[model samples]
Target chain A: MENVLELKNLKRHYPIYGGVFRKQVASVQALDGIDLSIRRGECLGLVGESGCGKTTTGKAIIRLDDPTSGNILFYHKEKKDGVDIATMSPRQMKKQGIRSKLQMVFQDPTTSMDPRMLVKQIIAEPLREQGGLSSRALENRVVELLELVGLTKDHPMRYPHEFSGGQRQRIAVARAIATNPEFIILDEPTSALDVSVQAQILNLLHELQQRLQLTYLFVTHHLLVVKYISHRLAVMYLGKLVEIADTDDLFNKPLHPYTHALLSGIPIPDVQHKLKRIVLSGDVPSPLNPPSGCRFHTRCPFVIDQCKSEEPVLEEVESAHKVACHRKNEVRKLVYDQFG
Target chain B: MPKLIQAEDVVTNFYTYEGVVKALNKVGLVVDHGATFGLVGESGCGKSVMVRSMMRIVQEPGQIEGGKVVLFFNGDQQQEAVDLLQQSEAYMEDLRGNHISMIFQEPNAALNPIMSIGDQISESFLFHRKKEMSKKILEDLSADDCRVFLPLKKLQQTLYTIAADNPKSFILIICSKIPILSLWQRRLKREALQRSIDIIRKLSISNPSETVHRYPHNLSGGMKQRIVIAIALACHPMLLIADEATSNLDVTIQAQILELLKDLKKTEIASILLITHDLGIVAETCDRVGVMYAGNLCEVADVEKLFQNPQHPYTKALLESVPKFSQEGRLRSIDGAVPNLVSPPSGCRFHPRCSHAMEICKQTFPEEIEIEENHMVACHLYVK
Candidate 1:
């Protein structure tokens, strides 16, 4: 499969002002130099704590918030070369209809959809904005989209608030797929719903991915949910990618200290499966004034002098298993000594 | 072990603009003394409502329509058992935060934003320990180490005496309204603050003095959560209900909180009622488990047994839906969403979503039957 999306040194920073003149004193480094790639029809799980910039990465990729710097290389199906989404102006992106090819499912379904608009109108509005369809064709497309997301064809007239949390999410999903986008950014898609509903939504996402051949950037804080859905997992700390590996490899044999601590943190349901978790000390540091060198060094259990001074970039120690840590080699032995 | 709390036939309803929403319908469960009894279910399944009803803190428009929440203070002491439903408002108030306490889900929302952490925690002590503080003051009066007299020493002692005699004294209430007289509570507040610091310190919070003085906004999520737990533990209640206690925290922080709770359960708290949607938390922390669906507890069993041999289809579906670390392929998600509580399904609430749903299931609710030792299930499929 071809690389659907490639992010190179993506940096999205918000300037912080101080004093009477409101001069920019510092920046809230939301997404600092994020480098990643997503293959065709593959789900890449972005897992991190709150304020760890997973959401910012999503927004930057789709240019929901125009990134401060770096390139978001998006591959078109027939195009010889990938286009830089970061450089494209909103009008240019819309004119080329590249924006339609990359759809986003927001975290909260309630606020994501306009409460006043009917479900059909909200789902149809996407197709309408994309243009060139008959009124009859648009109506049929809306019904088809609703049916695709497991909702009845007649739910178009009902408002978003009329539906349950799960149903509202289904409507949101229907809207995302209305244009038949090849790549979708699901930002905490099932976080608002119940577990039973989450499972249903996850299953629906899986089915849709298989049927539609959709590539996904699935972002969430829940490791278990991400583990189930994603083909590969990327662990992020304050504004930077710390690790990337296959889902199984990441969980089974995490190399990075942060990843090791993170994977251990997910409490397994069975008591017999007693996880010897390495709970890192302190909370995730603020992105505004993130720690020197490795951003995770502040909370990383094994903080070497080298880690404190020199920044470690994501490097592949093993095939398809990349880690950003000075002590990635030592982490295996440390985890083994403690948990194994 | 004798049951600390025996909640039988609890029927809670919310009189909303739409209609009377039956939040809990004949819900029943047992929490034994010294055991962490976990209630597992999806949100809006009345797990929270059940615990809230048990605490007699079900908010506005919501009422416990019927049923008894019998609490055994020290267990098997028949004379000590009192149905919380029949208790007077004052009696329930005394029982709440004294015998039973609760830890809310969100630390940020749970803690008072304007209040200092010390003040909020100390309020529990002030509310429950007025007599103790008064007795201490009287004891300290004779000792050489006793602090110097206030501007109104006689008035302060007299106020303490009145407060010690009756916490809700009419004179104190009237005095409380007066600007100058309200200062009488200063000594008591100081003692409570001291105790609050000790309590916060015990929750593994370093720098108790600084943390106590700081507002909720100044603290991190974990610190705020610890402070919440400290407040819940201040009274040393027989039962502590941590309602989704670790849901809003980071994974590492969640592990720490869970560990703290486990440790506290051993020495600090007697019995814990852990109400959460995470099956993992239920499995990891709880000894016994109860699975609720739309208001009805469909299954109750030992945590290990519940996970190993789940009888009810709902429980089975819930456990299967959780994407385990050891498992691969598609998770076995239950069909359909939770039924609408206002007009809940006629017979078995879970029948509409159950795979083995029978004709009888739609007609009447199934009674809870003990299939195995200590394992009880309420499902038509398990019917004899």
Candidate 2:
């Protein structure tokens, strides 16, 4: 499988200001040297808690938020061209057709969609701005996009407030797909919705992906939703990717202790099969001053002397299974001994 | 067992600018003594409203139009059951925190902003125990002794009062930097503060002496929720209504809170009416689960039975909609969104989204049928 999007040593840091002179006091490393890849037509799930930089990673991929330093390579097979979107100028990138190849679906549908604009205008605005289509052609494309996302043609005339949460999200999806982008970044797309409606949206995304062959970078905190939609999964902590592997392999044989703890934290329906949940003490540390060595070592259960001093790099231990932990094999053995 | 809390034909509605949102439609549920009755549903399904209605805590624009909330008191000389809905507003106030209490979803927002954590927990104890304590303090006292104790009692009462009475006099006389009476007043206040600290420590909070002094903003999400739980359990109310108490928390914190509630249940024997959207939480904590859809209870069954064999199409759809790790890469979602509550779909509310929806299901509402012992489902497919 060819890589559609790749990140090499990505880092995004925001400098803090303080004192009477407004001098730089310190820096908050939001993304610390992340290396990841999303294949063509594949859904890559970025799972992490709040403030873990998963959303930042998605925004970096779509160029909505520029990374401090990294290489973001977007491979466009149709044109047989590769563009490093990280350094591309906004206007130059738009003219070079990079904007039309990638888009984003925000988490909250109500806030994301323009209240003053009608559904037709909201969906057509992207097409008008990016594709530069005529008014009539834009209207036609809006109708088609709405229909593709399971909305009626009449929906275009209505304002966003008139629709339910799920319907509003469908409108957001229509707007994201208006330009027929090859890749979409779904940032907690269904977190604001009910469970049943979440199911509907998940199904819609699945159906749309199958029909349009769309690739996705799905960012969410819910493990179940990630398990449902993702082909590959990446577990992130603080600001770095801890583990990345095939969805099934990651869930069944998680190499990192953080990954195991995250999976066990999820409450399973069957009470009979009780998980020996590793209740992590204390809150997630501030991103401003993350701990030394591994960022997750503060909350990690299998913390060791080496894990406290030496930073571990992501190394492939099995086929397509990569883990960034000093004791990945030891953690795997512990998981097997207890769970298996 | 006798019902601890019984809500009969509760109808709650919100008059929004758009329209009248039918939040709760003739909802009826019972919470037996020491039993945890789980109300499971998707968001906007009125599960929270139904549980909130029990405590009469539904906010403005939303009112309980018609309902009877009866609470049977087991620990009394008379063994009487009172109709909580029929009580006067003043009398209902006395019953609220002492007899029935509620813990909301967001703990930070639910707690008082200006008050210390100790004072908030002590308010419930003061409200219910003040008169009794006063009597106990005045017991075996002569008329002259009572007169002597009067000034001390008045001073104690003034010290405990939360209202800002006589701010000038209080500042000059009680809290002055080097006043003669300030030292004695400080000692008196310290004694009252210690009582509040003892109550907070009873909730198993770490370092209650230190925690009681700080405001809610300094606490973490789980610690804040624990404080809220502590406040709700302060009075040892007969029925505890947890309205999405753990929904905002992460899974690890949620499991710990659930375990805490379970332990509290065994010791206190307080009936819990848990309102939640996650079926997994219900399966772990609840003994009996009631699944709701569009303001209707679609199914009610034991947690084990409901998980093993869900009879209602809506319940089955909800269970199947949850992605399981065992079935990774093969999970299938339910087809359509939940119907609008204001103008819900006619006949069966879940028919539009149900997989086994029939022609009859779209036109006729199904009656609740007993599939087996203690299990009831409302679906046309299970009628025969």
Candidate 3:
């Protein structure tokens, strides 16, 4: 399978100013040296806590936030060489047709859409950006998009606030795919919704992905939702990728200590299936002054002197499983011995 | 276990411009002493309105039309239960933060941004613990090794003695208006602040003294929630109502808070009424569960039975809709959206979307019946 998107050494830092002259005291390392790849027509789930930079990686790939340094390689069939979107300006991206191929659906549907415009105008905004469609064609396309997202033709005449949360999210999905994008970034798309409505949106996304052969970078903190949608899973901790593996492999036996703790923290809906939870001692450290060496050493239960002094690099411990833990072997043995 | 609180045929309505919104249609439930009761429903399903009506804190344009809320004191079944609906506004005000306190959903919105954390928490102490605090101040003033000035201590002693008898005394109100004389109760205020610090420390917050001095904006979401919990637990209320208190927090922080609440249940609070939409939270924390749909109570059962063998069609569909970990095939979503409460569907509001709805379901509401020992279901399918 061809790779749709590749991120190499991506970094984003926001400088904090203090003192009399407003000098730069320090910088928050929001995204520090992230390396990831998304294959064509595959959903990659990015799971992390609030400040782990999952949204930052999504924004950097779509150029919502400019990266400090790195290469975002986007491949096109006609062009054998992949284009570096990291350096592309807004106009350059539009001119090269990359803007239409990549799109994003925000977390909150209420604030992302305009209240003054009707649903027809909201969906037609993207088609109008692409240009060259007549008024009749645009109207037809708006009606088509509405039906595609499981809404009636009359829905295009209603404003955003007139619909419920589930219906509004459906409108947001309609707008995202209006441009026929091949890859989409869903940033906590279903977090703000109720469980039943969340299930509806998840099913819609699943059906759309299969029908269009679309690739997804599904970023969310909900573990079960990620497990349901993604083919592969990536666990991030304080702006760095700590583990990556197939969804089943990672869920069954996560290697990194952070990944294991995160998986166990989730409260399973079933009453009979009780799994022992590994609750981290304290809160996540601030990104402004992250802990030295391993970022997770401060809260890790199995921390050692070596872990506090030296950083471990991400390396493949198995065929398709990668972990960035110095004590992966010992942790794995202990986990297996206890559970088996 | 004796009943701590019970509501009978609670009906709440919102008189909107469009029409009347029947938010709660004869909702009824019970919470026993030393038990955690979970209310599960989607947004606008009247789970919140039912609790707010019981608390008598429903906002303007909303009114609790007809209901009886009976509150029993402690575990004594022999004692006569008090009808809270017939109580005066002043009596209810005293009962709010003293016997029954509530923790709101959004901590940022619930807390005042300008006030320091210490002052906000201590305010609860001042409201409900005034007599207790004033008695403590009297002890300090009358001690053998007292350090207060002689003349000032004499005036403070008289003031605190009156305060201990009646917190709403007229003489204290007059003295509070005087410029320099108002400072006589400084020792009492200090006592409340000390109690606030102790409660914050009890929640396992490190550096409670420093944390009390900071404002709400300086703290994280989890820390603000802890402050809210501190205020709710200040007076050792009999019932603590947590309305989606942990929904906005991260999973790890949520686990910590849930664990804290479980521990506190064994030590401090008598019973808890938890309102949330997550079934997982209900399964993990609640002893019994009540499922609400469109302002109506559909089912009430033990947590284990509700999860394993759901009786109501709506409850069955709700349990099926949630995605399990690494679930196979397509998810079976509930077919329709929640109905509009302003002009809700006739009869059972869930009939329009229920898979097993019968012809009689659209005509009249079903009476709640006990199918098993501790399980009750309100559905036409179960009525026969």
What is the lDDT of every predicted structure here? 0.90, 0.81, 0.91
TM-score head-to-head 2 vs 3, winner: 3
Cα deviation in Å at residue A66, candidate 2?
A: 2.1
Question: By descending DockQ, how would the candidates be arranged?
Answer: 1, 3, 2
Q: What does DockQ come to for candidate 2? A: 0.46
Query: What is the Å distance of residue B366 in model 1 from its true position?
Result: 0.7
Where does candidate 1 stray beyond 4 Å? Answer: B147-155
Question: Which wins on lDDT, candidate 1 or candidate 3?
Answer: 3
lDDT for each residue of candidate 1 in A79-121, tens digit (9 for 90 to 100): 8699999989999999987989999999999999998999889
Docking quality class, candidate 1: medium
Q: Which pairs of residues collide in candidate 1?
A: A120-A156
Residues A1-340 of candidate 3: C-alpha lDDT, one tens digit per residue: 7899999999999889999999999999999999888899999999999999999999999999999999999986467679999998999999999999999999999999999999999999999999999999999999988888899998998999999899999999999999999899999999988888899999999999999889999999999999999999999999999999999999998898888878877877788877777777778899999999999999887899989999999899998789999999898676556543
DockQ, per model, reads 0.77, 0.46, 0.75
- lDDT tens digits, residues B160-222, model 1? 888888888899999999998898888888889999989988988889988889999898899
Worst 10 residues of 2 chain A by lDDT: A270-279
For lDDT, the strongest prediction is 3
Off by over 4 Å in 2: A79-81, A335-340, B16-19, B75-79, B131-205, B328-336, B344-348, B351-367, B380-384
lDDT of 2 by residue, B1-384 (tens): 667877887888898886888877777777777789999988878888887777777899998899888788873323587877777888877887787888989997998888888777767765665544333333423335555457665654454342123323444454446565354344334444576677667656779899988888888788889889888887778888899999888766776688788888988647888988887788878988999998888898888899998888778778877876575454456666666677778788888887787899889878777889889888888754
